[model samples]
Target: MPDWATFAGFAGVVLVLLLLLAHASKSAVSGGTPIRGGVDRPQPGSVDPAVAEVHASLTNRVRATGRGTDPTHATQPQLSTLALLANVAVSQGAFGLLLLAGGWFTEIPPSAFGVTAPVLSASTLGVGVVLGGVLYAANEVGASVGERLGIGADEGLREALAPDSPAGWAVLLFLVLPIIAGFEELLFRGVLIGVFAAGFGVSPWLLAVGSSLAFALGHGAQGPAGVVVTGVLGFVLAAAFVLTGSLFVVVVAHYLVNALEFVVHEGMDVDWG
Candidate 1:
């Protein structure tokens, strides 16, 4: 039998960790300018000679989106892209280990958490890619809607997290993003909603609501509008999880959404804001 008490304890711990992470993210955003190759661009209503000189050098090659930094107003030390990526890797790795421990203690099979052996069929690959494309399109629309509603949705966090070099992009997309997608889908969809609903004999849809809220809250770094839009996105992904019963599908789809966001916005400098 599943260890209900252990599961409850595990879930509580996960919730606390997620909230702490979210708060830390918000705090991180409140201070330092996004480190764009150590170049501190001019912020609105203020300019520093050093920053202007650096900004001037890059003006011809890269368009400044006027998002992250005001060197004169910066209240914290700049966090390097490498350090930020390392922190993400360590944190998500720790979360994955915690989930494994929880599953072991709770006597929950991997399959119960939707970690089934992935199918290698072309159709499965097509489904995940197509689903990911649709979700990315939806996400853009949601961001637009948030803008129209005067939500002041900020992409600064995304800008801050963006990698600087081609090698960095490879790591971010292939390594970091995959870890994020896998861990998030497994924790939010597989365990929180799937295992809990199945074990407690409750409605998955109801659990989806709860999980989506947590998912949204976990993205607090994105600002107010992001929380709302992400909540909706979480529900859609949850629904996909419940209907398909495949973690692979959601992980692939999630990775694609994130990867495409970085590629289109940061890489191509689309300035969709």
Candidate 2:
């Protein structure tokens, strides 16, 4: 196994990449006309008076609050959301290049990098589906437990997943999420696990645990409970990677979990809103 110092340096590399994405996201856009997706979902208050204000002032003695408290409720262009989309793509791209460069330097085979599925048997796909369902159920229970413990919910992630408008929802569900699932599985499970286990001669299971922790920290914006949930999911995928060496399996599983969240919230109208 590599020394603690060595692992710390490796962690620093991941941190630098994450920090670069975050910084770029902050500076990527300016407040402009309604974003492309905003046409179908205009900022609600922009076109109308505050209904709560009118009601409170004119019709009732009690003061009432409108949707003003939740900025996400209004359909203005969310520069942060746009920036997040760009950051995930750019950061994942960089991660790919880094792995390729490492492969070349280390004289490692491309297959060793875990980019392609070594084998995709029907049994593997079936296992992935079962695992995906398990993750979804576990996350739901974990979230409820977290809330009871006063950890609250991961509103930040919910905002990204469930955009305010139809177009925003389309982009998030179709474009952004697939990319997120593919790239994340590739980076964490394929790349990170391969590097530590092969290059540093670390135990593959230990490397999986390390990558899972990094995955959790990557979602620091979601707070502690959110990190725990993400870490648990990461660990699940990592174990799958170690067993099957099937990139497709983890991607399908990850995508399924994400899709389930959207379906529950948007389609079923469950109250994570």
Candidate 3:
């Protein structure tokens, strides 16, 4: 059996960190900056091409609706892509360290976290790619349905996170998204559900619901509708993890979903909402 006391300590730290992140997200959206209405607008007088492009896109969206972009958010500052990347890298790196430390202290093997070597195959990767593509399509369909129903999502969050330069895009796609996907899956799926179940003998499906709620809450920056959408997505990912028992698969699929969202929505300007 694993060390219950140590596991409790690890869980406590993780919970605190998750709550902090969620609060920060809420603060980012709920502060003087309105949620950009439908899409993120550029900072006033910004010359960055990416910002310019986003502004143009936002303008077009507003024009299509025969309305103007929200003046409240017109002057709201856009987050620097590099700064956002650095912040995510540092936070996720800390999470990785905590995972390692917890494993060391509790004597939990990596397998308990779903890190297995045997599953690292081309076929496994292919499976992830397929799953990711399908999930992305499903998400688009859901978003379209939600839009038709007048249930709006916060596309501004994604727009603001989109990169401004080729180099920034590369970093976001190759490094940032993968780290986000990996750490999230490891914490939400592998540890919260998988390890806890193995260590405490609780039902993983129940844990899935609990962890999925946490996962959804962690994305509070995405707004209320986003929270609902994320909760459903989290559960689907959790189900995949529970069934496949492969962190690799879920990470890859998660990465693809995020990467495609950024690429298609922001980069390609194919707005589903």
Candidate 4:
């Protein structure tokens, strides 16, 4: 029942606020430097041998622990993959919940909400079961496949899916993530699509495709392949929104996907790598 304009306005405000808050938090944390005084400080003219030794010891310890080092040089690829997966789960979970609530209250369905829903739930699942399985099988067929070769595919699938968190983190999730998610869906899927479709006097499909592509491009940090995958997924989600003319379904589907991913990952020891 909610029009695209309404959704867009709401989403835009929330997105701006979330970005601002995140930036502020980051700045606050990064603004200060740790101070080690007294014993660590050297006297004028002469360096204290004890202080130098202590400093060297501390430096060595930090290096050994892999802290205070360049991430590119020091990071373990497998562990990095796992961490990325975890982060994806968290972000998607937060975003999906926000969309769900917004859609529910606004009386929108999946068709209106955007591609984030059906793509992740129905379409992506089917694709994964088919294409993902094929890829995995091919890897097993002795093609010099390494561990976590399925990581890229799995990561793509998981991004479409949503995630859950411990109950303890629920409050924080509700406060921050939902608002941001709601805003993004409203702006990108709802308003952008609506305006473009109207202005160009084009079919909904065209508008959806255009908007989704734009959405994918916004994630340039993810690289070309990732962008292509996301763009395709975006188109699917947009189609769902158009078909149903509602955001509610999209939101619910998004939430379910994320929640399921979290539950699965938490319960299973499937090596992310």
Candidate 5:
């Protein structure tokens, strides 16, 4: 296994590259040809409705064929295989930094919370049950949200926690999620906290409070109350990540928090009356 330093460096590089590639891809897509010629211009003396319709149809067809509507066509630029590889390399490189930072700083003891299982099977089973319950509750909450939105209530719940898609589901659950969790922890909790703390040179508690609030604001989609809760959670999670130097802990904790909220809202039959 690579050292923590190596992982952090790699993550940082990948993150930078992803940002660059996205920008470049967008630029290339926007640089296509404009539509100022042929049927689009329309004949000067043609007043006939049928003739105008024919011209309009031909103009649309031409545009669909990857020519003229705007000088720049809507079709995305076709990147070469090598370019695609380079883009991936850059993105993955940035992510490496976070992994390295997390690994270098955090330490996980061989035993979790000072408990060790006599049998591997028992440990695995316990983890599975906990994870499953959390996921179930998260799905329920997601379903409720979907119902309110008038979308696919049942499937949306499942899909909300599914991450990206079928082809990458296993990859996401096993690899991508952990990486994201680790990187996010490092960026939001580690770097952000360090920057603010250094700048303020105030009490650590105050630093945590301010940084956590900033973190919550970063997640603007969660609404005001949600943002406030997230901000508090951010402080705790950040401290944990910094203290332990293990992204795995943050990932598990995050999953647990999401699960807990879902269970509280959906599993508990609370009476509004």
Candidate 6:
């Protein structure tokens, strides 16, 4: 177990890294803000209803009839990933600072981060995969139930996962999904749990429950049922972290849940646009 200073040093490095990444991402997206519908049109623009209808019809027809992009392959989504990336990085960086101020990184278990040989055993890999699969199934079932109860998912999350090309899916699987999972676990589990348990002398289960509530409430954008489902899942994840003392375990499960959601439910779709 590392004392507060050791943990703070590691967190400081993470803070600096995330801040740099966020700055770069924000700069990259400084141009081309996403606009939505006619509401997003430039100021001082006005149109007659009949002319607008005609233009709308033509645009829709073109979208429906167009086969594919030109060989030049000049196409892009209405939005960019940079904004999302920047926000995540900035938020995580801020969380790092909070952890330092609160001395939340005190007395971390070595197993928390899965410190081990460079090469993992096959059995270890297998166990991780199985754990991830189980969590993935639970998350999916929770999301489904939430949807049935009219608790819509976060809009930004939905748009991000909308079906796109294989390249897009690959980008998410390799780059975005793991980053999100790791960031969330680092904040909610690693930092928050440490803060409560070590800083406040909270027991493991109590810290897990308390931090899990915060985790779920943080997804306030996802609505009530989303809060409920996520809160439950968050508790389970926190409990697992406490029991196994493996941050890697929770990260893997979280990543698989997100990746599977996108690939299985939202990756492949008949082109409707």
lDDT score for residue 28 of model 6: 28
How do the residues 83-178 of candidate 6 rate in per-residue lDDT, one tens digit apiece?
333334445446545554444346555333433353345654565577779877876676666557655343333433243566555555676566
Computed on alpha carbons, the lDDT of every model, listed in order, comes to 0.67, 0.56, 0.68, 0.41, 0.39, 0.51
TM-score of every prediction relative to native: 0.79, 0.66, 0.80, 0.43, 0.38, 0.60
Q: How displaced is residue 219 in candidate 4, in Å?
A: 2.6
Best by lDDT: 3
- Point to the candidate with the largest TM-score: 3
**Cα lDDT tens digits for candidate 2, 125-229:** 788888889988887787778767877543323433345566656665676566667667766787678655666678889989988987776654444566677
TM-score: model 4 vs. ground truth: 0.43
Model 3, position 259, has a per-residue lDDT of: 87
Model 3, span 5-89: residue lDDT tens = 6875786688677667555445533432333453433222211112222333444444555434465543333334555565566
TM-score quality measure for candidate 2: 0.66
Order of quality (lDDT): 3, 1, 2, 6, 4, 5
Give the lDDT of residue 154 in candidate 3. Answer: 40
Q: Which residue runs of candidate 3 sit more than 4 Å off their true CA positions?
A: 31-79
Q: Give the distance in Å from residue 243's predicted Cα in candidate 5 to where it truly belongs.
A: 6.6
Rank the candidate models, highest TM-score first: 3, 1, 2, 6, 4, 5
| Cα distance off (Å), candidate 4, residue 208 | 0.7
Choose 3 or 6, whichever is better by TM-score: 3
Each prediction's RMSD to truth: 8.1, 10.8, 7.6, 14.3, 15.3, 11.3
